[model samples]
Target: MSRDVVPTYVGTSFHVCSDRAADISRSGSRTSSLISSPSSVRTVTRRQSTSANTLLTLDPRRSRSPSRTESGDLIVRQPAKRVPLVRRTQHEAGPATPQSSAMSDAAKIQLVCTLGPASLDPDVIRKLDARGVDLFRLNLSHTGLEELAATVEFFRRHSEAPLSLDTEGAQVRCGSVVPDLVLAQGAEVELTADEVQGSADRLSLRPRSTFQALRPRSRVGIDFHGVLLRVIETGPASARAVVDRGGRIGSNKAVTIDPSPILPALTDKDVAAIAIGRRMGIDHYALSFATSGRAVRRIRELIPPGAHLISKIESRAGVQNMDGIIEASDAVLLDRGDLSREVPLEEVPYYQKAIARRANRLRKPLYVATNLLESMVLNSRPTVAEVNDVANTLLDGAHGLVLAAETAIGVDPVGAVDMVKRAIEAFERIPVGLDFTAPGAETDGALLTLR
Candidate 1:
């Protein structure tokens, strides 16, 4: 007896054609063989009256290839290898189709704002959010978990934005000094591990490792926030250095050394910060002073599965291992503040361009951080140089721009964000096809491209 067969379609119907003899045989082997043969298969697709669906079917035996219709429907030929089927549905009353790639490209430049006293108000944060602030960064070096817990709770309660916790990674700084030391140029001072009330003559540097790593002739920048010192003598527990550039050095200020000394990638404080951040449901962590893929991997083991990692490259070692670090990180940040201290200040722009190029070529997001809008920290308006700097950074293919101290402790935090937003808008206005080449730009070390 001949049998009728039906093929299933979601809210649709399919008409199958088969030989009467094959259907009447009713033998399982024959039926299977008939169904498996390409020549014996014929299908007619029918659309439901209630819905419109576009289905592209490929004929395995047909030599004539399929082509597109004027209505924008695509027809594909069968491939040598098996290809998965795709279905597209169009609804008359549904929302328009989303162009995800275009939307992503349009908003590729992210704005990261650091939250502090000035920006902690709900009104300020909402304004920033409306202006396109993508994430809020918390500096652990300045605030502990206890203090940040309230901020975290506030964000969770008031906003849908994600938070990024930045660890104070292996930073060396001056400890408590009884009297802030005044080291004049050509004067000598001792950096010791011993806990002492530091004077102009002797200053205390904790972690002892910093002292052990010092050698004669080493250049030490005491508080780039303050003075510059050069080592004249080295000791087991202390190093005697002369002030190359003189200024008053105060307590709790950062120190930088040439050929950056060996220090732990993550400090004890950093470990504690990471633990606290994990508990606070932080979505991202910025690993400060990241130098290698190994260090990033170590950090990865600590963060939760879905949390993103941003590696801040702020040292020569980090520049040297840029490829590995970028490969291992979800994103890279060019922290110009600490980085300028390590390298000559004049070399910062070059390094920024090189790093930005690498990041762009790899398609990894790069954040140009620090000093973008420094003037806005105090003034209601940013300087012309600062505006140009912001524009050029965006033109250099930076995926994001970070507002550090400008937002963290600035007098006009919202104004700073607005200024940056305007800069970004101006950058976007530049004709996409414009040539950005400058005089001697090819040799000037800036990455210039014709988009």
Candidate 2:
């Protein structure tokens, strides 16, 4: 039998279903009887009012049923079973585009833009929104409570994109160092626990616990390993180090130490920020440096009930505990920046693909963040390599791509957003299969042949 297709609205979009046999069996030939008899048939079709994602079923008996008009032609009206369409924000992205309609929930690429001085303006936010920004991230590490509240209020007034408050999990960073101190090779410097205006010879670091963990001959990296320093001596609240690799160091840059110290998952500032965020009705929270399932559950408890918890995997512990963390959280985020501190730079890509595949298997959303368009931080266009990387990330099972400095502090914030949108579209255009299996895939010989 030729299948009868019924076109109906699942949400705002129309979905076609083919299940005429079930409808016929349920209606007991009443439809056939009416269709066979034209005299009793009437063209009575009323479209259910759909206002702003309202879910309403189309009933053929009352409105949309096949009938015969005066022209002696059969008119077929589609009737669909009731299916509730739950509304989701862009952050919880679903396959909405026609090209992506058949894609599963994991295939929808969410565009997450971090709000910063460059893109925090109302106009820029609106532009990013128009380009389809799914979520706006507020880095708690860089924001105080008052400023965080104000920023949250400001975005609420401007855009409807969901806000994500990213906690500053256990990490060390350089305190106020003015004039961009350029440390030369073999230059001796002092890293103090005391807060001070830093200079070439002396600097301060935060989370004194990490300073206390330092030992003689320990290797330290500053500003994403821009400059390398080795500890020459340790003190009660400080450490003296000699520069091994020279580079310009700036204020608020990340600092990494060998034998990373054990710190609390949530900082005092993070708790304060969460309290402020809860008051503001923010429902999305990203826990930075999420090391284990226990930590994810802990943060999940602190947030509002039913709020989306995104665990950021950036440390060695995080990678080791990936399965448990992915199982515990609503979603997972692969932070390649801080992750490199523990993981070698060359191995980052391998980790990214592995994390993406794991997240896909566990049916959780995974967002890749950091340096997506690094060159665009100063330049108007992204590097070719960066574009390729974005596309490959999607192919590797990343449900979303996050623009940090690219949209937050880049020279052309809107342009960066546009590029991300373009990258997603380009990825969708490719017909590459992400889940491919070789014949007898379990065997090493088959796997090698496929490779």
Candidate 3:
């Protein structure tokens, strides 16, 4: 039997009764044994090794040398690998037939929709909620407290989905630039210290005081499509600079009048909006231009404890301090509109990926925003690029995607939200770098895209 290892084809495996032990059987040239307990398992194999002689004595070879030359002793005891217990989420604990945990995490990616003129209807709100829209963003930049409170009331009465109020942080904007002050090749645009007279329909110029903080000739940028700015010009009432390139500037739209936004977290407008948000039971507040943890802390000091804060990563400062700012807030929103203004346009995608990865790691839900379907505002559809952008970010693990002009003032608000939901679902199905089985992973993170 030990001349050489031969192919042993098993015919019938006989199982022992009441023993729960599976072992080799050899009534012929094979082997058989009964497995009992740890108490008996070592005994069975130990017992079998030496006991082989007793059985072999019965063999016709009657005392021939042991048949199993190098064959190791049988020990049918699998260290009883304690099957690890799985931790289930709340939804799993419910009656949903225990869907794949992968799908479950996908469902957890908080879907936030911005509400405005286009999406104000009760039915539309109900539809959005049904489709998994987890939160509604009220743009405090445009909607005053009264309007916001009313919107909040409508949302509460219509659905229990959460609320995120976005407060425009202190940002510089172009003062009145003669509504259509078109600059010819040689024309000069001036920001005067004096206000446009009453006939000019403008308020008097006031010093922001922080502007004094600027050193002479530092760059003061007023950015829009692409940033066209000027170096500081020293003056008595106001400063003068040329719009190296020109575009239409409206009254109070926003002027970097200076280098950085020189104000604190809670502007007078923010304070008022926060007071109203508290009264209205808003769940979260979005702080634009969130520069440091201190900015969120300042706003936190003002809002009621029930309400949380989300930092809007919109500027160079915001991106540079993303980790600290994200640490300070309950959530984060990547506002690419202002963000593009702050970073090189080519770099926004990279920023989006980095920010999403950081937020996902911290277990904080993140929102990607700005022109995500901007084209859909007028057209009923999105280009292939816009579609892929949403999917890529979803693959990147973004918790939500925000639509500003697409939803706020878009011609078809409900349609825009529907489009986003579809894009998300489509992306979720596409194969990506995600191993959904891994912990803390969902379809929204770098889905194995070709870099």
Candidate 4:
């Protein structure tokens, strides 16, 4: 061994050979000295290396024993594994304030847009999806199941949020009207109890027998909120009426008799809507004439698992059963239009506040759905009052907002969405809550709202 040779410890055992090997070509005389003691000798065979790692083999017989490991040539210990971080459905998002630079791109309001001609393009749907439209509402009341299903697919393919189907539930409506036919005040209109399954596309001055069930002094309403009419004459062939809340009764408009105290709510149309909604991959069925908890359950039974049921407070029964309905439903829709007719128009604001406050207290996500952006239907701009109404509804802690004709068949669907988006930004800028998820913790709604 060279006098300069020194010993080193790799780990705690097996000493390396330092006495130079014999027989190759040296003139030096060296004595045989096993660097590895037989009692604690261990061996590590180096195999072929590959990739970014190397394979090492240690036969147990030659593996490091406790005795050898105390002074081993190589310390073979497992490397500490690194855990990959996975993110949840949560986002570190703040309020969507236009003025605040801290806004998170993921923060969004679950805006539900009704599908119609106004916004049908695939590209437009994609844009709306990216713009934070969280859900799509397919008004099954008017569209066929096939078309509705297709539209639902379109919506789903475009965005995976969810779809809401408005049931055709037994909402009364005026007979379909002819284009430009105006029902002036004091004008007589006829309806028939026996409605032909045939679609009524063109309006006729001729009276139909559908009004036979109506009695003298019977009050009928069109569009639910547009016009309130009274029966002047009733017969098998024709009925007559005068307009009170006189807007022109138009095509496919609803005709509702002032619900008697005895009339049961939610017609067969609503049941059909519920069935179709269940058939589709819809996430929610907005109960049209949800009068009570029973009414909501009536529809919920027919829906799929994880599907949400929303009771709409638009009728006297809904108002009377408000607490029960809210408790039964996953959410509730405060419809201003039907509320105007079912309850006195002047009382709507009061009820709106009452319902909103109660819904907020209960923690169920509440949505204010109606003609919020009505001005967008005509001009590209929305009225200031309309904007303020959106802001106020947000301030009241509504979880979602809806658009109707303004987005359904209006001229500028994108602009209407933009208008709504801008309104949301303005409303969120005026923060009222530290956290918006009031009802449930870690719920999808809560997570979305917090985002």
- Over 249-333, each residue of candidate 2 has an lDDT whose tens digit, in order, gives 8877778888777877898889989998888778889999888888988887788887888899998778777888888987889
lDDT of each: 0.66, 0.71, 0.56, 0.56
How many residue pairs collide in each prediction?
A: 1, 0, 24, 18
RMSD (Å) of each candidate, 1 decimal: 21.3, 18.6, 21.7, 29.0
lDDT of 3 by residue, 84-184 (tens): 11222211221111232323343444556788877778887787777767567887666765576677787788877667778777565444445454443
Error of 1 at 134 (Å): 0.7
Error of 4 at 281 (Å): 2.7
The digit string of per-residue lDDT tens for model 1 on 91-132 reads 111111123132323334678999887888888888887776
On lDDT, the leading prediction is: 2
| All candidates in order of lDDT, best leading | 2, 1, 4, 3
Candidate 3 residue 37 C-alpha distance from true site, Å: 42
Error of 1 at 345 (Å): 2.0
Q: Give candidate 2's TM-score.
A: 0.73
- CA displacement after TM-score superposition, residue 307 of candidate 1 (Å): 1.0
